[model samples]
Target: MSADLWKPSAEIKTLQQRAAILRTIREFFCDRDVMEVETPSLSAASVTDVHLASFNTTFVGPGHAGGLPLYLQTSPEFAMKRLLAAGSGAIFQLCKAFRNEEAGKHHNPEFTMLEWYRPGFNEFTLMDEVDELMQLILAVQPAERLTYQQAFQQALGIDPLTASLESLQQLAIQQGFADIAEYETHRDTLLQLLFCMKVEPKIGQNKPCFVYHFPASQAALASICEHDQRVAGRFELYYQNMELANGFNELTNAKEQAKRFNEDNAHRKANNLKEVPMDTRLIAALEHGLGQCAGVALGIDRLVMLATRKETIKEVIAFDVGRA
Candidate 1:
């Protein structure tokens, strides 16, 4: 019960800026012939990624029937892909997404997401589109592009794709990062630490930067690099060390997707978390055939924050769930 916790003037200005940015975004896509689309907020299954914790709830049907398990989507990715498979060309959506265990200056349990897909486009083509859209929305020049390896090399003097786990851990310690031993077994955990502690702070100093071609193991939902075989077709946009978007070439192989999903579930089980059911409908949609496409999900709040130079996520949001 803090009396000074609220600020009406600051919140109103932030909301105004946020609305202007959203309007600009819609106008940008409209001018580019990207149709705005909407999808379900609740699903029978949630994303299987072990790193993301989905918010689960129970829904009661007609006649006061027993509740059925449901989950608020972490992103509109699966449903949007289903639409892509069914021939929705060049679509975009701005919607609210939920995650269970995220709350910080940059994170909230409920936040806005701007997701888009480009049919018949590869990673590079869609990345250019993202750049143009960002410029249009922010009324600023386009950002720079840096490969994942290049960013790591510039920050830590090591090739992330080739560095051993011990090397990464040692570097973390040398950089005065505490809890280095805590991430020795998880390669991604160590990479995340280094990226956040050393690399990210140096990115997008002048303009946004697209960090592309991630290691295959950290692909998440992106396709693997055919040329290198050890890297994936993934990229994340950063502005002033803040993550703004994640994009990738769509992985259309249903079988490979299933394998990856299973691997994710195995990791979940090992971590003593509930194994999320795979989206069979998505798999079916993939089996029916989806064209070569690339998609991206950007944090709308963070974009607004960057545009307005806001420090905390709550400043950009109107009535954050915690306050609600």
Candidate 2:
């Protein structure tokens, strides 16, 4: 046996802090009438977002002629939406989400996620709620709201919507990004690189920040801005230069949502990644009317790291992946 194999990664004090934090989170939602919920961790299908990788396993039982593939849910968004479609109002779930190849300082193959949806709330109103939630949890000041356009312009001196591909590549090179050439001519990829290398480092330096109005191409589950079709109604919260939460004015149209899922799988195939099966049930829920709402997913482990003043997520989690 390896030495110290039985010891947990987190100290008793850190674990106590975690317990207290979870308690406060529950109280916060309870005070607001948000019902706590639970959903299955395994699913017949998983998220097809190119940025995420889902874990898969074979399910063999009496119901199957052979083993059937099941995916570990990357987030509870789909199931929670189904609940909303079934008329469950304002619900929150504090549960585990699993992803492949995702263990690090702020990530684990299996990690806690706190997700909620507020019916009749748009992204802006939900942002205010997020501000309140952050203050309640982290003792943080009111978060400043900034647009994607403004963040890009202020940090990198380029308008993200209108910046030329050549300019993006040139600026990335100037910032000492050696991999700029590898990104080639994909505008979105170059924009992402620029944002990561340049703008992201300067965000949420002192107080919290909410960056919204993302480019339409980056709209994962968010609705497009009706007035400005170039942008999506999504927001991401950052704290002390670390990303903390992502919220969206959710897309409600079934046809559009289906198209996006297919597009995501197509993109995955084009990049030589495995294409995930489409989540037909979620689409059915959308077709049945998911309603207008805003939802967000926050990384609970990362929040615990901040609340406990720990340097890495491993310090706050009960067990690290290796130990688990």
Candidate 3:
């Protein structure tokens, strides 16, 4: 073993700055009267999002004889939503989130997440709050808003909402992604690859940018826009070409939420990945009634990287997954 293995991944000074920024985040929410709350890092169910992977462990001691399986939450979104359904007004959580197969310049398997939910707030209103926090933390100007369609049109000269799968495949090939032919049926996958490779690094370089009105098919947990059926009321905040936050005008309908979860499982099966158990408790909470609300999950380590002008997440985190 190397002697340097005992050293922290981040410098002492950087950790200090990271702590100060966390304190600032608390103050920001406190000023807005958002109550800070906590949730368990482990749960019986995990997100069914195909793009994300969860870490699992077995609990040997339980009320029963058999070992119980549980997953380390990728985010506190589900538990927090349960709180919202129980009538917790304007709550936020600064917690540790875990994901498998994620470790890079921008990603760590275990990282800090700042997530909050605001009842009676739409995607637009919640975006303004996110912008305010970004401005205060990164000292950036007010974010410029752009629809998903506009972003694609401006970056690749194609309308993402109307483009056919065949056309997107051809475009991806032209853009040197010839392997995209293997997943020709996955329209969202092609769009995401194009956006990350071609669009993301270009925007949010000059100022923070708010990309909203994503295609309804890619809405994740957000609600479909009332006026535009083709799009959803979801938004993401990006700064210096780094995605800082993802927010949504939350979906409160139990049936729709269940439908999405089933659809996700179907996709996972088609892709030959393990089908995760859906959060029936969350659905029950929705059935009991979760009113209009908006929620966001922001990456704390990434924010610290931007604030300190660091190149990688390791420079901001006290000990990244490698050191841990």
Candidate 4:
């Protein structure tokens, strides 16, 4: 490697901006009486979300996890939920998170995440908080709240819920999208393709936007909407063609959660990916009776990119994996 590779990727002023942003974030939470917290970056039980990959390592020592594999924390959700189960109300954390297969203009193998929980809040309430935070940070206009169905309908001229697989596939082909045949059989994958290629780029072009009521299949850990039955209680915050946060109305049913984990592992098996270790502690927490709560995990680096008006995340972060 050249000597220049040792140089920090971010300029001094950008580093200043990052520091200031951190301070502002802490102040934001403090003002709301949300206690700041810290949790482990590694866990014996990793996440089982099929879409997320966790970096694993083996521990070797006496009186400890001898020869046992531990996974880097993908998010602080499980631990935070465990705290909520222990009666810790309204907590937030700004910490390092890891994923195995991620590297791009907006992704890093290791990244910063700002995760928080609000007890007694529903999905809509959390979405409103996210919008308000954007207003506080970016001074942006009031966010446009769009349902997943509405976004798909106006952006792609199809109703996502009622559209058949062939219709979605044909739309993809018509949009000059190539190699979508592999995704044709998967409904969620097709929806993702259309949303990413057609809808997402158009959202938050001029202001922050909140897209909610995701399809049940792609909800991950969110609960299914009681009224709609088909939509999950999930919302994503976006600005300037970038996704900044993912929020969910916490699902407290232990059995349903375990079922989802098993399904996720099965999907991973079908895809030939490693099946992640299930977080039994989190499941136990749910069994212990977690109260109604909604939480969100925001990408701090991406937020910094937006706050600093940087074109790419590399400009705001001190180092990308390539440079590190």
Model 3 error, position 239 (Å):
1.1
Ranking by TM-score: 3, 2, 4, 1
For residue 17, give model 4's deviation from the true position in Å: 0.8
- TM-score, per-candidate, Cα-based: 0.94, 0.97, 0.99, 0.97
Best by TM-score: 3
Predicted structure with the largest lDDT when compared to the true one: 3
What are the lDDT scores of the predictions, listed in order?
0.88, 0.91, 0.93, 0.90
Between prediction 1 and prediction 4, the one with superior TM-score is: 4
In candidate 2, the residue pairs with backbone N, CA or C atoms under 3 Å apart (3 or more residues apart, or in different chains) clash, namely: none
Q: For residues 1-324, write the lDDT of model 3, one tens digit per residue.
A: 888978999999999999999999999999999999999999999999999999999888758458788999999999999999998999999999999999999999999999999999999999989999998998988999999999999999999999999999999999999976556689999999999899887788899998999999998699999899999999998888789999999999999999999999999999999999999999999999999999999999999999999999999987887789
Worst 10 residues of 3 by lDDT: 60-69
> How many collisions between residues are there in candidate 3?
0
> Can you tell me which runs of candidate 3 are displaced by over 4 Å?
none
Task: Give per-model CA RMSD.
Answer: 1.9, 1.1, 0.8, 1.3
lDDT of candidate 4 over 1-324, digit per residue (tens): 787988788888998989998998899999999999999997899988877888988888886645877889999999999999999999999999999889888888989999999999999999888888888888899899999999988888899988888887888888877587446587788888889878999888899889999998889799999999889999998888899999999898999999999999998898888888789999999999999999999999999899888887778888888798
lDDT string for model 1 (1-324, tens) is 667555442478778878988998999889989999999999988899988999888889885488888899999999999999999889999999999889988998999999999998999999999999888777667888999999999987899998888887788888887566445677787888788878999988788899999988888688999899888999999887789999999899999888899999998898799999999989999999998999999999898888888898888887676565
Model 4 ranges with Cα > 4 A deviation: 64-66
Of 2 and 3, the candidate ahead on lDDT is 3
Cα-based lDDT at residue 164, candidate 4: 84
